[model samples]
Target chain A: MDSELPPLLVLGPPAVFNIFKSQYPHKYRFLNAFSSDLPLLQFLQTQNTHPSSVRAIFCNQRQLVTADIIRSLPSLGIIATSTVGYDHIDTTECRRRGIQIATLGSQFAADVADMAVALLIDVIFKISAGDRFVKKLVPFKPWSFPSDSKLGGKRIGIIGLGRIGAEVAKRLEAFDCIIMYHSRNKNPSVSYTFYSNVLDLASDSDVLVLCCPLTEQTKYIVNKEVMLALGKDGIIVNIGRGALVDENELVQCLMKGEIRGAGLDVFENEPYVPKELFSLDNVVLSPHAAALTLDCFMDSCRHVAKSLDAFFSS
Target chain B: MDSELPPLLVLGPPAVFNIFKSQYPHKYRFLNAFSSDLPLLQFLQTQNTHPSSVRAIFCNQRQLVTADIIRSLPSLGIIATSTVGYDHIDTTECRRRGIQIATLGSQFAADVADMAVALLIDVIFKISAGDRFVKKLVPFKPWSFPSDSKLGGKRIGIIGLGRIGAEVAKRLEAFDCIIMYHSRNKNPSVSYTFYSNVLDLASDSDVLVLCCPLTEQTKYIVNKEVMLALGKDGIIVNIGRGALVDENELVQCLMKGEIRGAGLDVFENEPYVPKELFSLDNVVLSPHAAALTLDCFMDSCRHVAKSLDAFFSS
Candidate 1:
């Protein structure tokens, strides 16, 4: 085990531990931490630390991650984030370091796309909020309530054209909804048109979903300016990172009814959600759980373990 | 206006009103009701003091409607239900009355399909429960509550294969669910295999949705007998009619968990719920609101208006 290769370092997603042990066996020694924002810089940069022992740095956006952690892993030959979005990692630094980077395979388009459906339905239907009420473990006046808004014939906008965007388009086939998207390029997957800017997507969309990743090219994409353009009678769902949206802008839009509602699974501070966001009835907040499922967890773990096997075997 | 003839009578769903009113115009006066039930019959018997003026009887399965309604209306020439289910009209009586029984061409299929999808998700995901929790207008522990079970790779069973049943098939195509169904005749719509009886469908299905309408042949179909067959890991969704399933059987299955959960939108006695069923988190209840969209309301109203047009025009 020791002669062939250095140890593998998995730095995010607690679900990855079981996956690594099962898939790779006695391959690279795995260094995994339970929480995000682990003190990787301090831990590895200590005077006596051996940087040559690490081979790869695997990451996920959530779990309180910091970009500096990846830069400090001197022996990280590969940097992979389980999610399609990689803004959590310093990609420029990885590129400069000649790190081979990987995200999930392109076919996982449906994972994010299907989740977009789940979140969209969650927003329009107010599903998560409704579920909590019923689970009160008591019986109440079931029929005495306000009527929910229906999703039929509503307008929706997609803001990206990557794998996830195409899959979201296909699944929405029977909804009878009018579709418009703001993709960097026109996609041949569906007849959905491309809007040049986020403004166009926001202006007309009854439901505006952020599918684009958060990056220098796309960070704070849904700012106060864009939220103002979106106006009221609109809903937003961000399955991507919270940094992609300006928290201050979102709070104002929601408070002022500039946007009717939002369905957010990711947050600006995650474990420390803004108290105002929690109190809103129109918003459905989940703590960074969109990309999770029993299957996704197990599969991602197995993939990382397999990568560890290659690093050790070669 | 006096020269134009009143439109013939038709029985069935009220969705077919637009076509007849828009196309036939002043040429027809219509007689229409939103439902095929005992009240409609009692109303007709009282109204039709003489038969010579009546032109047709359009009807579906509900009341004991037959030759008597047609005989009472001697001028009756056509009968129709805006539904595929024709159990109420008595086709044999229509044949003897020399009445042309016509039903609406496109039926409640798309709506029912969407409802089934909603129910399947609701039953498993506890959507109604979620709706209640959200409506509470309370602060919730967002991070702690999970999305519940997922639909990927679960086995789903559908019963009945008429119009609505077929649409359920088309919409579930994107989900990675294994599909099976039970219909009297083999459906050529998709590759889903046929189950000869309810027991077979119950035995294999993780979720069992009632798509067949209520009838003497199908009444009390999902009794304690089928509940026993479903074992413990089953979920049931009923959109067909409340009478089709024995409510007691449902309560028992839920209490003992012979079935894992259920989502009920319609009931044997609706707008008046069974008090016993209210306390279970294993169930989701709505006031038969699946078809209660603005589109449905407008469509039903227009159907009544058009039928009046046809009746008055003639």
Candidate 2:
């Protein structure tokens, strides 16, 4: 390690640490926590330098920067997370301590929007279901299977018309989808119809794409009533947080065909998705990987490095 | 049946016959072949009316209109098919006999284009594969799976820049993909780059989308050499006829990792896909349902009925 290099504590999924270390050459001396078998507190205590030397902590959603973790890092000036969502970090504590926060921000918008559209298209066209049917060697009769819905001219309701939602709208527009949205306030920049309430948006739309962050007011935003309003022909695509939808209601609706289908990238319980969803052909499930594309991940890695460099220099 | 009503022969999948009969009402007297237990010729002979009275045939890809079938209907004037591809009919024989042929034409282009983009996104983002992995209840880890490729900034070469190809290019452009083409002639209407030779196009593209019609000159157009040119990271999306690609070569290339993946909606033989494709996560297979969306199917049915009505009126 270069003596002149600034030291930063790196805590996240081992994969992120490895990628940053390998792909991003050393601008900072990364004190990788995974390199120590000891617990995080003990690892920090055992470091040759004082805890105050580490001015910034590089992390992601995999590791939470709880109040305890923040307290232990005596001189931590900023919590730089390589994810758009910072719900995992102790922002309240950071606010009290006057420690700033830096996030990947809109850097992940395009890749996540691509995933939202991809999932929506997959559901409407029955691509995943058709793939299973073909691979299972089911006897194919001409026009035997129920016909799929076309993407063109369908009204798509975007729950959050933020960066990702705007990108989703832009892509789906080429498919001729009617774009509608529900957000905190009416956006003056775009011409898409805005509904203040999500229920009204669901009733008038064919598909609902969740792209909002998980906040107190937005948690369980898509409940049973909202789903019913979307009707039996509706589809739900969640590229946002898992808790944005009530997973139980979603599973029940999918099971009973209350809603036509769903393409879920995030689940309430995460890796512990309802086993009932396993057999449903109308539903397409993905692990939480909306922003995991190589391009997005590398971009985020670069953003994190830049944020750290700026914070330490200031 | 009304004596003034024009008698017409309907031979195709039973679904088409049922839908047309139920939806089309009393426009004409349908001499449905499936209604009789006897062979088609015998069924016509057993009918009290003369075979020459049935002057038009309404069929689809499910039924072949061969020279023998045409010979039996001495007064046959037109063969109207409810599909974009007219290769199923004996066009050469129709030309010799001075009989007219009508197809759905560009009506199915939008639906087919939608499927092409859906398949492309599904393959590139690993949507189907991710769905399978999540459904299979595999242990999920952050950044565990290989990072997926992004759609933006990718060079996509369209094999046939006709109506369907043009529609596909329009949709993909919204995702920020660079569009190139290989067609019979340079299409001057659009500004997309055109390549007269497909090999050069393959070399320049990261993805190849097949949208051309299948004919003697175009059969086996994407062979081993083209696949090799596409390289290991390249993907092939076939929404056109299956015979356009050498299935054996494609299967081998996919198996050897010579090419990244494939999204096939058509095959050399109908309903008989290669068994090797069953276990591959890199491939998404649809049972020839590209133009089978409910909206598209109903539209084509209406078009077929109009074609038949026009022929009978003349």
Candidate 3:
């Protein structure tokens, strides 16, 4: 019965495998790379079955599905990623091999947008700082602690009004924020003030939210000039990816108070944040877990399973 | 020339005076009590001018306008407070003496509501915990760190559907939250589900947010019973007043894990928080600073000045 089932290649960390295993339909048998004692390529080479039998690859955000992984599997027809961002996957390699890519498609947009606003408010209100002050023996001086500005009526510039960016714009609207966007093309459906140039957007905005994808054209988009344009009273919130901004420049800007503060969930290096940001009360840092909610994970799992099932059965 | 200007009595800490003094219209001469070496009552007694000369008192959130103070001023025509809640002022004494009372009238509603949503997201997503973990030497594990649920589609029961509560509802709606409320009366302006009974609201809600004013009837509204009904998966957010929930019961619930977590901006005691909560990761504490923003404070100063001017002119 197990032999009759289609073979699915499971890529990424063990955590993704655990979640995918629970939600995935039993129609496909998973060749779990994470569970193998040997390296992924060696484990595949040792598999008694033919490499062409692996019809699909299930990948998550944590692991990169490199070109080598794509070239190794001859029958890999579809790569289903359980996240909105596909920068971790070798998309150019997959395109060259004529592989269909299935993304979670804004399923986790609300979660990510919620975090963007969360970090924005935390920075503006010095919420985490206040929490630390209260927890610490330091006196709770309201006037001194949160002398920052309010969230309402501030001009907010959003990069890439895609699914996550659109969700962020919608949420900030409720706060009475003046929303503007710098996307590849101005969205005709919405009436938000459009800025074709990101530098212009940063210059006009009190806050800049990065929700765009990480691509060749977009890597290090928020460089020194953009940060300087944002001014000392401005803030930056990156929920998109770490490489979206020049991380070193960000740290320098924050340290010098050139840009007021930052609320970064993504860093240039994952799991490794700059030590300078640790002591700065103005900057709030999170370990890239914005879309790691149980609900989002479950949704992602089901979406990947459904997409793979559809591709195979068709 | 100074006597030509109407005398306006200023009360509260020196911080309030600093802000009040900046925006105050020159028409009124401030009898600044906060800067005086003598106590408030002693300061009043030491004044060379007759008590009848003082026509209006400007008080901020930090000070309490007691019955004794009201009795001391024979010509007090109006008391203007630079906050939404007037519980600090002796309302009963003002009513007896036919003295009018003026409040900021939801000027800080957006700021407070923004903080409410900020606290909610921080508690749910473990943004602060994630920051702490990253800042510390702990390994960044996505699945392990944020094992909590998402903010979207949660049944949030707002305790008061007033100005602040209304703003919270509007913001949460963008996150796709199902907002319910248990206010003194059902608000006709909103379409959210209304529960007249507090117990029913708590039982049905995954999260309970206290945004109502602290009053005689509303004091300790969330007691042990309410917490139990909210259950172990529940979260409490107090951006209103601290006394809205029984602080002892809340502390017990949090300790025992009777409820999941809390995001508190207000406490029963100002500047002093419970020592037990310092080590807990579930509770996020702030120093009663929901409305402590530069924009909100300036708006409040302007509002107080306008109201006082209008009252005297009328």
What is each predicted model's overall lDDT from 0 to 1? 0.63, 0.85, 0.85
Candidate 3, A150-187: lDDT as tens digits: 78888999998998999999999999999999999989
| Model 1 C-alpha lDDT per residue in residues B254-302, reported as the tens digit of each score | 8887878887766776445676676675676655555544455455445
Clashing residue pairs in all predictions, respectively, total 48, 0, 0
Candidate 3 - chain A - TM: 0.93
Ranking by TM-score: 2, 3, 1
Q: What DockQ do you compute for every candidate structure?
A: 0.14, 0.63, 0.64
Which ten contiguous residues of candidate 1 chain A have the minimum total lDDT?
Answer: A138-147
lDDT of 2 by residue, A1-314 (tens): 56458777888753356667777666777788856788776787776656778788888776778999888878989888878888778888999999988988887788889899989888888888788788873345333444547888999999999999999999999989999999999999999999999999999999999999888889999999999999999999999888899999999999999999999998886558899999887888887777766666677777877887788778
> By DockQ, is 2 or 3 better?
3
Return the DockQ of model 1: 0.14
Name the lDDT value of residue A147 in candidate 1: 32
lDDT order of candidates, top first: 3, 2, 1
Instruction: Give the best candidate by TM-score.
Output: 2
Q: Select the stronger candidate by DockQ from 1 and 2.
A: 2
